[model samples]
Each structure stands twice: as C-alpha cells, then as structure tokens.
Target chain A: MIPLLKRVAVILAAASFAGALVVAMLDLPAPTVHLPAAVEANMAASGVAHPVTAVLLNFRGYDTLLEVGVLLLALLGVLAVTGVRAAPRAVAPAEPAKRMLARLLAPLMMLVAVYLLWAGAIQPGGAFQAGAVLAAAAVLLHLTGILPGWGAPGPRLRVSLAAGFLIFLAVAGALLARGALLAYPPAQAGMLILLIEAGLMVSLGLILAGLFLLLSRDSGDEA
Target chain B: MSASLAFDLLLAAALLWSAWRALATPDIFRAVVLFIVFGLLLTLAWARLAAPDIALAEAAIGAGLTGALLLDAVGALGSRKDGAP
Candidate 1:
C-alpha cells in the first residue's frame, strides 16, 4: 500500500508538470523590447556601444577579474604542490583512431580560439570563452604527446602564469587613478575592452593549462 | 510565459535529473562525473535564463576547474586505498 501510494504521488506530480508546461507553451510571448524613456535616452547617448561586452569588462569587471584570479591561483597552487616533489604520472598513449581525429581537429580548434578572443573586443565572444576553448586544445595536444611535459615548470612558465593578473591590475589601477577603476580612456571603450580582453585570453589559457599540469593527466576516476 | 522561461524550465529539469542521478550512483567516480555534467547543464540553463556571465564562470570554475579537482582527489583516494595494508 505504501509503495502504491508513492507511485500514485509520482504520477500525479508528473501529470501536473506536463499540464503547466502545455499552458506555458501556449502563452509564450513574442520577442519584444520596451525600455523606459531614461534607458532609451542613455542608449541613444552612447552612440558607439557594445553593452554586453561593456557589462562584462566594466560594470561586472571586478567579478570577471577575480574569476580569472581564481584560475591563476589554482594553477600556482598545483604547480607548487606537484612541480618537482611529486612523481609525474606517465600518460597512456591515445588510441590510433583518436589520434587521427585529434590531428584533423587541431587546426580548427586553434582557429576558433583565436576567433573567439578577437571577437570579444567588438562582439559577443570574450576571453573566458576563448580561453576555455584554447585550454581544451592544449589538453588535447598534451594528451597526444604533441607537446610532452618537460618536468617542473620553468621560469618562463612562472612569469606567463601571472601575466594576466599583472596586466589587468596595472591597467585597472591606471584607469582608476585617471578617473574610474575600469573606465574607458575618455570614450575609448572599445579599445579598453580590446586590451583587457586580449590580456585575459592569454591569462585564462595559461591558467587552464596550468590546471592540466596540476592534475598531471586525464585519468578516469570519480571524486 | 516566454521563450526564455520555457527554456529555463527545460534546463532546470535536466539539471535536477543529473544531480539526482549523480547522488544515487554507487560508483563515487561516476557520481562526481555526473555532478560535473550537472554543472554543465546548469551553465546552459544560466545562458538560457539571461546570465551569460554566470554561465561563463559556471563553465570555467564550476565544470572545468571543479572537474579537474575531483579527478585529482580521485587519484589521491585511489593511491591511499592501495597504500593501506
């Protein structure tokens, strides 16, 4: 009886959800924008505006910066933990089928990463998106032995690791000194986005690559 | 009701199902991988729900970094189990 009651309850819940979904689909509104007068005026004033990118690198710039910092610090921690002391794991060779696919996709992956970074300055894509793609590519390359680990991160790796943070902080500081913490260079908003976005792409990619180094290799296991 | 709202509901349901399965799975490793899948689904949900910034962070920190950490922890756990007499 208890089991039967539970089954009934589940059926009832599923039925109710389906009913609501049907109602929602029927009532779906067409796409429309009706901004208030003040916002409309503001948009007009900002003739050359990329609102999404602006929001990403200026309004919520701090959050974005910190997010990158988290990745950077994570890599640093991993490097310290496993750089020299920890014995490196020998990555298993990729299957022949996968190797061919990876090689075929490599150039395309590189192109997409570059495109995403370049587009971020003027359009929808940005550093984080591009960096993630680039990192995936790096992981693939590492896995295929196209770029083998040379034991311990060298001096170049150390400096490259912090490049994004150093660039972001210094530029933001200069901006703050002049006017606001990430304010455009007196309406050079596009350029500011470009600079930061470019720097972020490099930083994000390196940081992700560092995480790969930390974990050593892609091992199939659960936490 | 709107297109975005409909999309959100769909994504939410998917995310919930993944999370539920992740918790129920007997294999700890499978559970962790499911959790990462849950994160990915949630990131897509965020995008549909009009929070691309949140989605970006979710994919990077939540799915990417967190997944890597879980894999690392799994290795540590495996080694420890093996080390035990």
Candidate 2:
C-alpha cells in the first residue's frame, strides 16, 4: 500500500532542509543590533521593573491591545458559529469525587491566577498567564458539571468579556490626547499598567472561558 | 559533555520525537496527548533558555488550556460520530 517514490522524495527533502538548517546555525553572524541593551537602558521609564512585562504592557502596548481585541473577536466568532439562540441545558452530574475535587481546586486556581497577575509587575507572570489559569478553573468546573456550558452570554457577561479591551482602548485614547498612544506619564506608569493588567486579566479570563463554554453547549444538547 | 548540556540535548531529542509522534499517530486522542507532551517539553526548553515568562505561558496556555480544548473537541467528535448513522 505504501508509495515508495513519494516517501523517498519526502526523505530527501527533509534531509536537505535539515542540512541547510544545521549549516545556517553553524555559520550564524553576530547581531548588528542589541535590543536587550536598549530595553535595559529604558527599563526605568517603562514603568514596570520586569523587562518582559514592560515590553508587553508598556513599550509594546499596542500589540497587546490588538491581541486582546483579536481574542475577543475569536470568541465572538465562536459565538456566531455556535449561534446565540441555543438555550443552556443542564448537564448530568459528574462523579462525586470529581465534583468535590472541582470544588476544592477551583478556588485554589483562582488564587493562583490572582497571584500571577500581581506578580507580573515585578516577575515572570502577567495577565495572559493569569487569565489562562482562571479559564482553566472554569473549564474544570464545567467538566465536573458544577458550571453549565454558557448559552448566549447575558448583557453583564458580555460587558465583562469586553471590559479588558475597552479599558485598554480608553487608556490608549487618553494617552493619545495627552501626547502619544499608551505613553503613560512617568509618575502614573506603574498604576496605569496595573489597571490595564487587572482589566485584561478579568476580560481575558472570561473570553477564554467563553470559547470553551459556548462550543461545549452543542455537545450537551447532543448528549 | 557537561551534565546540563547533555540534559538539554536529551530534552531537544524528546521534543523532536514527541512532535513527530504527535503528527504521525493514527489515533487522534494519542496525537493530542503527544502534542500536549510536546508543549510541556517546549516549556522546559523555554525555561532552559532563561525565559520563565514564556515557559509559564507555554505550560498554562499551550499545554494546559489547549490540551483541554483539544480533548473536549475529540470527545465531542467521538460522541457525534457515535450518534450518527
């Protein structure tokens, strides 16, 4: 059943590609520009002690803003595909052990999410990771039948989902009025970044959770 | 020759092998599981490269959240197939 010629062709192509990559790596040239040094030089003004955080939330806030928007759009796309009219259905109860474990772990995961959000200002954690952990908690709850798959998100839920992007946009608008986009005043940089991160953490959590929750309703209906 | 270098080489090999298996596996569930393993290995690689932020994100979002989503998709697909004629 095998196609020997095609397989041989594939092997040859792969070997050549690998050989090229190895040669390229071996003969790499030194960098012309040192971005890390530039980032380090400006770290004091970037508002966050953590260089990565500063780059993500301050130096390149526009990208993060767009990323948040993209995520929200993705959730909206999921909602559109799933159709907003599907009614929330009750899921059968999971095993008692799973239920209890979900109850125990959900709160702990929330605490970790918050800790990651807080630590992002000075360490290797941020809104994206924090929001992911929060979403995981919600997923765990749903899997255990503690939380039902979401139907059409209510007005309140919708607002929560958009809150992060809205907040980021508002900040950018205000900063633009003052001078430039997301250019936090040196004195207020820390507070502004924190505020943005807080908003993002909440909205990202909701949006990420919504992706799973919305699509999952179909399985519940089919079941 | 050093211990850390050896560990890094082993990790790299494991990453490549898992990635290959994830792609080549016939079983959808096994492939997804292998993909998750690949993600975790990638997180280790990120950590070894001194990027803990990336490692944490990879572990949580890449491995944890994506794995859950894929597993859910597989379950949904399997159930749909069973219900169909």
Candidate 3:
C-alpha cells in the first residue's frame, strides 16, 4: 500500500510539472522584443560590432571579471576537498586511432578557437566561447598524451591561469584612477577590449582544463 | 500546425521524455546519459528560440563539460564502491 502511494505521489508530481510547462509555453510572449536605441548607441561607442561582446566586455565588464574569479574559486574549493595532486606528465593512449585523431584535431581546434576569438568582434562568438573551444583543444591534447597532466602545473601555467583576471583588474584599476571605473578612453576602447579578451581567452582555457584534470579520479595516482 | 511548429512540438516532447527518464531511472549511469541528452535537447530549444549564442554555450559548456564532469564523478564513486586498485 505504501509503495502504491509513493507511485501515485510521483505521478502527481509529474502531472503538476507537465501542467506548469504547458502554461509557460502558452504564456511566453512572441520573441520580437526590440533592442533599445541607447544600447545601439553604446555598442557603437564600445567599438565592437558584435553587440554581445561589447556588452560583456564593456557595459558589464565587472560582471565578467567577477565571473572569472568565480571559476578560480571553484577550482580552489575542489582542491581543498579532494586534495588530489596532479601527475607530472601524461601517458599516451595505445590506440593509434586516438593518437591520430588528437594530432589531426588539436591544430584544427586551435585554429577554430582563434578564429572564434577574432570573429567575436563581428559575429556570434566571444571570449567565453573561444575560451571553451580552446579548453576543448587542450583537453584533446591531454587525453592523447600530447600535453602533461595538470597535476604539476608549472610557473607558466600558473601565470596563464591568472592572466585574464589580472588583466581585467588592471584595466579597471587604471580606469578608476583616470576618472570612472571601467570607463575606457573612447578612442582606445576597441584596443583595450581586445587586449583584455586575449588575456581572458588564455586564462579561461587553462582554468577550465585545470578544473577537469583536478577532478579526474586518477590525476595524481597515474604519475 | 505548420511543419516547423510540429518540429518544435516534437523537440519539446523529446526534452520532457528524456528529463523524466533521467529523473526516474534506477541506474545512475543511465540517468546521467539521459541528462546529457536532455541538455542537448535544451541546446536545440535555445536555437529554436533564435538565441544562437546561448545555444552554443548550452551545447559546449552545459552538455559537453557538465557531462564530462558527471561521468568522471560516477566513475570515481563506482571505483570507491568496488575498491578497485
């Protein structure tokens, strides 16, 4: 009798969720919202043709900066909890096909990542997307034993991991000294955004790859 | 309904089905796999809503990275339970 009651409760919960979903689907307004003119004007001033990039890097720059810090914080939490060190080097998989795929795909992914970063100024790509792609490439390399395990990240890796957050903070600090916080000189806005984005892309890639490696069950044990 | 609407309906149904299975499955690994499928379906739904940027993020970070993390966690838990060397 209790089992039957439990099943009925589950069914009731599912039905409630389904009903809510239908209501939400029916109530959603048509996706024809207009972009505010002020946003367009600001986008022009921000110097990136891609509105999303401009907004993320300029209008809401602080949010993005804080987000990178949040990513770092997550890694720190994982480290404290797991206490698993990283291996100094990676072992290549025995399968020739896996190695071949890594060799062929790594360069291609790197190219695509860079392209995404560059195109973000004019298209749907941006620092976050480019960083994720770069991380994917790094994961591919690590998986196939092209790169060392993150268990023993060197000085270079440490610098790279902090590059994005540091660069962002520096920019914000410089702007604050000049006049307003995060307000770049109109003429140099484009260059500054690009510079920050480049640093962010590298750091984001490293941080993400580091997180994955750190969380893997045998990172330190394999070495 | 038009063909596109039919497609959208099918996609939404698929999303619900996969989500339900993921929640109800007895096997943890199967649930994770189904969750990944649900994330993929969400990516499609984002694209259908004309949010390509969000769709890209959902596909890469949401489905790809999260799925990888979850699978690793499952493996770790299984190993601990089995006392594998």
The candidate that wins on DockQ is 2
TM-score of chain A of each: 0.69, 0.92, 0.83
Model 3, span B1-85: residue lDDT tens: 5999999999999998999999989888999999999999999999999877778778878888788878867776765444355
Worst 10 residues of 2 chain B by lDDT: B76-85
Please give the distance, in angstroms, between residue A74's alpha carbon in candidate 1 and its true position after superposition. 2.3
Candidate 3's DockQ: 0.41
Candidate 3, residues A1-223: lDDT per residue as tens digits? Answer: 4599899998999899989998999999977866656568788789788887887888888899899999888877876776745445465564888888989998898888788888888888877888888887777777677776656557887888889999999999999999988988878998999999999988998788787776763643533
Residue-level error in angstroms, candidate 3, position A1: 14
Best by TM-score: 2
Q: Candidate 2 lDDT, tens digit per residue, B1-85?
A: 5999999999999999999999999888999999999999999999999999999999988998889889878888876555366
Docking class of 3: acceptable
DockQ of each: 0.19, 0.65, 0.41
Candidate 2 versus the native: TM-score? 0.93
Stretches > 4 Å off in candidate 3: A1-37, A84-92, A217-223, B80-85
Model 3, position A26, has a per-residue lDDT of: 100
True contacts kept of each: 0.17, 0.54, 0.31
Off by over 4 Å in 2: A1-4, A7-11, A221-223, B80-85
- Give the DockQ ranking, best first: 2, 3, 1
Rank by TM-score (best first) = 2, 3, 1
lDDT of 2 by residue, A115-198 (tens): 999999899999999999999999889888889888778889989999999999999999999999999998899999999999
